[model samples]
Target: MGRDLSGTIRSFLIILALSTCCFTTAPPDLQARVEQLEKYYVEIKEHFEAKIIDLETKVVRLEAKVEKQDSLLADLKKGHKPLKENVDINQHCRQNATLRTCHEIHVANPSYPSGMYWIDPDGQGIGDPPIHVYCEMEAEQSDVKGTTSILHDSESQMDIGNCTEPGCYSRPIKYYASDRQIEALIQLSTYCHQNIMYHCRKTPLNFNGIAYAWWNDKDGERHKFSNRSTTCDQLAYTEGYDLQYVVDNVSLPITRIHFSNPFKGFGQHQVSRLRCRGKAKTEAMPRSCEDLWRMGHNLNGIYSVKGAKQMETVFCQFDKRPNEQDFQKRIGYQDIKTRPVYFSGEGRRLFMEKLIPIPFDHDVVNIGGAMDSHSGVFTAPSTGTYFFSFTGLTGFKGGVVITEFTFLSSRGVEEKIMKHSTISFSKLTTFNPITVQSTLRLQAGDKVWINLDFRNDATFRFVDNTIFSGWLLEEEI
Candidate 1:
């Protein structure tokens, strides 16, 4: 029994040893497993951290994109503001108001000669209204410019102010005062005067009357007076004058008056007196008292006429003034019949028959004119349609003539006129003279002169006589 108990003890000790070894090995394996788990946990934490960083980056990008879009929308909202309400008001006023009608009634008068209505449409009567409007608009616009900033701040106040209400139409809104309307009317009147009246001055007269006229009654007789003329003889005798006298009295100077000799009964003294008084001898015949009384009253019977009527007949005539044809044919005659001066020069003489220069590239030859050394330019004193003529004998070769002319202009801006022409010799002594004609539009301030340029070094000889003839012309009706 002792042996058996000893064996059991040995078995128990072996099992305990085995159990201790298995326990130590299990702990080492478990520790290794725990280390592997720790490594896996560290990898998971790093992955989670990386994922979180990526998500944060994506969120930041989206936020910036949203912010940019939001800013763009805000800017778009700010750019499109409404126009001012005053613009509407002004448009309405302009549309409703008849600026022209107001002007005609307020500023124009139908009767007075100096009144606005009588002003010619093409005359200076127009442009007054537009100028006034421009001035007022300019001033008001300047004020608007200065106050624009304050206006922007009070944008809400720019509303039309309940004008759309139903009762506002009948009830006069106190906004547009009577004084404002009066001022507007005055402005419109002035505008019409300036624009219509002033611009009308440029128009031509189509009808035949004084620009303005009026009728007046004096001594129970009605008379018409013209603004342009003050001739008492022009008074039409519609009902008063017994005999109308048609006189041959022109505005021009009278050279002479002729009358035919009277009949044998008329005395020389009566004929001479009739001639001096611009009456025909037939019209001035002396009559006996009996004959003169017979036309007006009943004569007493029985008594014969004491003197027979001295019958006379005379031809009324006047000297014929030089016609336009005569004046045109005469050369070298001053416009006022003054003597013409001759010029001696080395080049061909150039004459500007008209104040205006001929068109460019015109053949001007043998034109006669004297180049005045004393005066730089030719002086045309008389103001009329002048024929400026010059004759050139073709002795000069390779010579250029420059006619430097100036015309005084009452209206236009150009002050100087220039013309150029070349002179060429045909043979040793023979040359063709060029003629240039130009209708110069001249005013009172224009003067014409000639110059010479020689190219061949040869001395040019030209006649110096220049003709400036002008005839007085009536103003265009």
Candidate 2:
């Protein structure tokens, strides 16, 4: 409005000037008219400026309202509980409700580039606190996507050449995040990798199947810079020579790096940036307690899993029964025969090598149904340590009674485990009993039984006092 009014006033003044020029004199009312037009333009400009200011204020308020509405809508769509108005969802990566890592952020918003971000690796309210970290979100041909944590970067070279051994120089790695936080990330991740770069001088990293440099992984295991090969000869020949390697065999993180100068060569070396990345296990589904434990679950209690046949809940005693089922594996049996069983070594068998399995025909208890009373064999339902005990009495006849616990492998091979012998030479020692116990580790499908043998050619008689018992002790993961 101000501009239009000014243009109209200028046009009117121009016409008056032209007319005055034609008459060679100015009209008396020309000055008064111009002053009146100027006053009117000032009033119009003031009014329009006030209106523009008012409209701008209204737009700002509307934008604030829209932002609030968007936040509420997003929460509703994700089925998340509405947060307080004072809470800022963007405070940390996990605070976004769905973005646990920077990789997830990049996935949610593809246009987001890699940079520093606040990440709560252990989730929003558990484990370690949030920490700032750099992320690498660049898309590559391999289609690999994950959050990367920088461990170490050698901005300048450092030489270590005074000694001559596999670990001539060792340095503990300084990671960007705490060890607990990194371990939490590894548990949540399906696959993890670390990139390593080494710059060597005149001496090669490896020669004639001997490595001069290696690093220890998160589990304190050593991994050579090169296998039993001379590949480093080609890569680390000159001062500027370098080699890049990726560690992905195990999901564990790296804790330290080492270099060696076995030949005492005139060479120097420097390690470049070490970055680790982990891909989230979005599809992880644990089917057993072992699986849960492997996934970083450390608590013990009743948990559900896909059992041998169907879904079932079992007690997870991670400290001992790591892979045990809900039912206890225990069995006890005894030979409850009315007639006396006789064992004669005179013509039946040799002195020590020959053995006969005890026929414990009566069962006292078979909890897990792993022991067979008919065959007198206890088959291990799972791989674990077990305890077995046997008690036998020489009824009335005096003889040397020897008994032992033997293991029958799945391959049908028998191995002696534990043995006990009793000497009953007189009537006073006729009732002497032999008790033997042992703890053995058995694999799944392995079988165990008791064997009887006589040390001498004397006959030994046994009654219903013969007893055998076994139970699972601890399960292995």
Each prediction's number of clashing residue pairs: 41, 0
Off by over 4 Å in 1: 1-387, 402-420, 425-434, 453-458, 464-466, 474-477
**TM-score against truth, every candidate:** 0.19, 0.49
**Which tens-of-lDDT digit does each residue in 399-452 have in candidate 2?**
677678989988888888887777766644366667788888888899887777
Error of 1 at 416 (Å): 6.4
Each model's C-alpha lDDT?
0.28, 0.58
RMSD of each: 44.0, 25.3
Q: How close is candidate 1 to the true structure, as a TM-score?
A: 0.19
lDDT of 2: 0.58
Backbone clashes (count) for model 1: 41
